[model samples]
Target: MQVYKAFFKIIQKNRGQILIYLVVFMVLALLLTNTYNPPQDTDFSKVKVNIAFINNDSDSQLVAGLKTYLDENANLVDLPDDTQKLQDALFFREVEYILRVPAGFTEAMLSGQNVQLEKTTVPDSTSNVYMDLLINKYLNTAQTYTTYLPGLSQADLTQYLARDLAEQSEVTLISNGSHSANAEKSGYYFNYLSYSMFAILILGVSSVMLVFNDTDLKRRNLCSPIRSATINFQMILGNLSFAILTWLVLISASFVMYGSFMFTPPGMLLLLNSFVFTLAALSISYLIGNLVKSRGAMSAVANVFALGTSFISGVFVPQELLGDNVLTIASFTPTYWYIKANNEIAAAVSFNADTLQSIFTSMVLVLAFGVAVLAVTLVLIKQRRVEA
Candidate 1:
């Protein structure tokens, strides 16, 4: 009881720092969620890039058809044919791509000659790549038609290419209503939760553990009537209580911000992931608290451990965009699995056995990380006790 009382007393003494960390992170989370508004619907839509089209070639049905196709797939910017103006347009990001159709462009395609279409582009533009792919697809398909159908006229050629290109595969968004405004925001909160939760747990547990780690405090507790086991147990209880309270506050914030939507199935599972992650974070904090010999080291440990892992674990960035090597490295950390689970949880359109199995597997891996770290912490503590 004494150790437990002292544990929270230390927390109270350090309340200012704790409160600052909590408030700052919570505000940041809110701001980020507000700024990043994901689309409400999961419908597939092509990202149209701005392009400046300059037709050096004479008027022809094929060219008109090409311009119409560009219009359909991209945002064609009306820019003067001046070289300086086009360069400036690209430099200023007013256009992601530029196309200059040569005078014989249509004839070259009809003749099946290998003459390239002259083009300008914003350097290293992703949209430029897509535009290139699109144009190649059109030209290649048109050439194939011309080679195979020698008697086809230009108007007939344009008609055939347009019809062929119009065919597109259907895409279905298999998600569990994650596009709902509340669910999208909730997913963001959960992803960013790793950082704040890690920091707070580290701060809270380390503050208490640091105090108890003091040699004089340890000797005093040993000399007291309470057994070593009781002191350790009470300390564990205090740490767990603090961790649980912090978790509740965060969870409650989501519920408050999102209303009853938080009680939905996906939302509740999000809560479960956060809870498991909190335990792993607590174990990490315990290890850091014991290893770090002074209060001055706590801030460094918290920032480095919290922020570093957040960056590598798909908290700041997304797992989808992360490279395979980065993901492989991230897999070693429980934060990766936690975020991975959170992602799957949101995208889970159905709660069939297969989906649940994947989600539970991730959760179990996270818990395993916590249990393993706790075992290591116990071993370290036991070794120190023997030496003392």
Candidate 2:
């Protein structure tokens, strides 16, 4: 009880550092949520291209139909035929495409001869390519109709083509039990939350260990009536209590931020995954605390482990953007599994064997890592005691 109480007192003394990390976690969560808010539903069918057209063809039904098609698909703007004016419009992005229907365009189409329309635009323009595709589709449909429906008069042909081209088909998109908008946001929030957990656990536990490792305090504790094993057990219990408190605080914050969504299956899985990762983090911190002798050295180790793993494991940058080589290296760290599991949970629509298997695999790996590090910590502690 004395050792446990003393351990907690050390943690209480470092509460300011712990509180700073907590505050940072909440602030970052809010900032990321606002910055990456999901886009609202939009009507894409009404989108139009901005274009400038130069129609030099004579009065003919075919040319008239082409003019109508261009007007319907694009926002037609009038600009003078002056070279400088056209160049200025192109340079300023006032129009995506500048099209010229030459004088013989109508005659060539009517006579069944292939003719190419001239287009002018700035270099490497993506909108220009899209506009070009639309133009080609309209002209190709008109040409095919003229070739097959030769019996129709010019006016009827033009009217039929216009009606046919104007028709639009409706499309509906459906989700197959995958993640929702809220789930995606939650994933990102938790991915970043790992950094806070790592820093708090390492700094908190290492600070306690530093106080216990004091030579005078250690000699006094050895002279006391308490068994060394009993003292060690109490210290372990205290560390576990501190870790649980930190985990609960973070988990509660997530629930407050996300509401009932945190109770969903995917959400629960995210929490569970984070819990496993927390255990791994605790074990690693314990190992570090045992190895490092000074508070300054402990702080340096905490910063390196926390920030370095966070950046490499996709907490700071998305996993999708990380290079394969970087991911390959990050795979050795627990944060990688933590983020990977969160991603899988966020993307899954329903809980199934496959989902369970994948998540469990990561959980087992995290646990394994914790157990391995804990074993090493115990061995090192035993070796140090023997040396003493």
Candidate 3:
């Protein structure tokens, strides 16, 4: 048909652009896929943390005992009596934790007064957790010692240790372990998703451009012998080709980056889900082209719709952060369904009858959207022909 011929001409002229876009997309996809390094599940050894303790009182025996205990279990450092130097070391992160003993720490412990031992450590450090466990261990040891003493009761020693030091021991955990490996992983995930969705802008722009192109060139085609439907069909095929190409690039990238052996058969399900999502994009793009006559105007609208919907749908950020209103609206977006499906597959959620049914639902919705767009475009063409 005349329309098919025209389409061939356009393809020949624009082959370069298609190739360039394909290559760029492929590279980006590979980079993202390669970055996905899942944490290994094993009993990993913990990092060593250095700790400094300053004894205020001359409790040589108590200090020696404590130092020996810590040195055996943890990396303990004895610092100068200078308080300012200890503070500087803490600020510099040279030590994971610092402990301070009052002037009468040893005397208080001997006098059966409640001794207040101070413990300091980097805030949120796994070291802090370990330190707490060690302190509890020391307490248990002291209780065992008291049980053997004829006159000393466990409570008596505990009270004496506290009163002698003026109060019970207070542990202060203080540096920067706020962000863990898992947190870093989350950041990477968000960044990858953000970049991936950014590419959707191309889809929007191309859709709008195609719409305007049809409106502008349609009159010229009407004068020729080719049926408009045939021309439209060619265009539709081109769009399908582009969508399929993009999906393949993404899947291939994942394989290249993670190694072909990483993703198993079930993992392939995520790729399939992503492919289904592309059909949704195709339908929406076709609808936009048929509805909008001005390329520039449609481009502007496309940007707004794509960005707004993607943001609200958790493509740009975590879906959990979005409130009920934004979340409720996001469900209507095709991107939401696909995103959800991708996540579910990644997490390896149980694949039951419900999941199969949901997949069928997604496919149905996408098919329906494509059919609607085709119907609308036909109606518009008929109207234009009648007017002419």
Candidate 4:
């Protein structure tokens, strides 16, 4: 009990470092929440742009029909037939494009003569590109009709063009049949747990270990009446208590941000993956604590390992975008498997054998990593005891 109390007393002295990591994690969580909106799906819609039509030619059935077509596809703005107004309209973005049908434009098309229609728009305008396509679509279809059916009247051509262009096939967006959006949002939050948990656990655990490993302190503990086993058990309990509380704080914050998403099946799996990773983080902290003799060395090792592994393990960047050589090395680390599991959980909608096995296998691998590191740390500690 005394050792357990002492373990936390050492941590209280180092609370500033923990608060820094906690605040950083909170900022990161807020950013992730903003970035991962649930309604990522957007429906397809035809883009319509505002445009002005100038008919320099007398009204004819063909020109009238073309104007009608443009009206349907775009917002036709009316401006005074003045040069300044037109230029100002274009500059101010009130109109993205303008079409000027020159006199005798209809006659040129029926007689197989090419007439370039005057146009105005800003340079490199994307809306104008779509407008060009629309204009070309109508004229090109008109040209085809006149070439093959020269006897066809302008009225017939317009009628046929409308009918041909009117037919459209069905368009829709496909979905993954589950709460993929929510899963994705939660996934990002969990994926970020790696770096935060690693840094916090390392600094907290190692600092306490360093204090307890002080030579004068260790000699006093060894000579005390209390059994060594009780001290060791209390120390282990204190460390576990600290680690679990850290994990709970992070989980509670997520619950506040994401609500019941933290309790959903996939969300629960995300929690499980992160919990296993927390264990892995604890093991590494234990190992580093036993090895590093100074606070400065502990801080350096914590940052280097936490940031370096996060970079290679798909925390800062996705594993897919990382170089193959980098991934080959990262695969050796437990964080890589943890991230892989998070991604899989986000994409998954069902708990079929294949999906469950995939997620569980990743958890097992991460747990195995923690077990291996913890075993090594224990071995090192035992060797030190024998030497003493």
RMSD of 1: 5.7
Model 1 poorest ten-residue lDDT run: 173-182
> Each model's TM-score, in the order given?
0.70, 0.85, 0.60, 0.72
17, model 2: CA deviation in Å?
3.6
lDDT of 4 by residue, 1-388 (tens): 8999999998999999888888988899899888765764566678789999999988888898888888989999998778899999999999989889999999998886776899999889888899999899889999998888887898898899888877778877675466656687778888888888999999999999999899899999999998999999999998899999899988778888878777888888998889899989999899999999899999899899999999999998988899999998998999999999999898886778899998899999999999999999999999999998
Off by over 4 Å in 1: 40-178
Q: Candidate 3 lDDT, tens digit per residue, 1-388?
A: 4444454455455455445545655554455445757567554455666888776777465556665566766777767867788778877988878877678765555544566678766778888888778765665555444545545643565554444433346656552222223223323332243224334434443543463356456567666676766766766666677566556655554454444432554355655656666666666666665566564655565567666777887766667788989888888776666655544444443466776677657656655655676578668757966876
Off by over 4 Å in 4: 1-41, 56-58, 80-84, 102-104, 112-116, 178-192, 215-242, 256-259, 296-388
Candidate 2 residues 1-388, lDDT tens each?
9899988899999998889888999899888777876747554645677788887888789778877888988888898877799888988889878998898987676555677998997668777777888888878876787688765566876887889888988789775664568788899888988999999999999999888888898899999999999999999899888888898888786787778999998889999998888889999999998888888898888889999999999999989999999999999999998999998998788878988999899888988989999999999989988988
Candidate 1, 250-339: lDDT as tens digits: 777787678887788889999999999999988988998899877779888898988888898899898889899998998999999999
Candidate RMSDs in Å, in order, are 5.7, 3.3, 8.6, 5.1
The TM-score of candidate 2 is: 0.85
Backbone clashes counted, model 2: 2
The backbone clash count of each candidate, in order, is 1, 2, 17, 0
Residue 212 C-alpha lDDT in model 3 = 33
On lDDT, who's better, 2 or 3? 2
Error of 2 at 57 (Å): 2.7
Scored by lDDT, model 1 comes in at 0.86
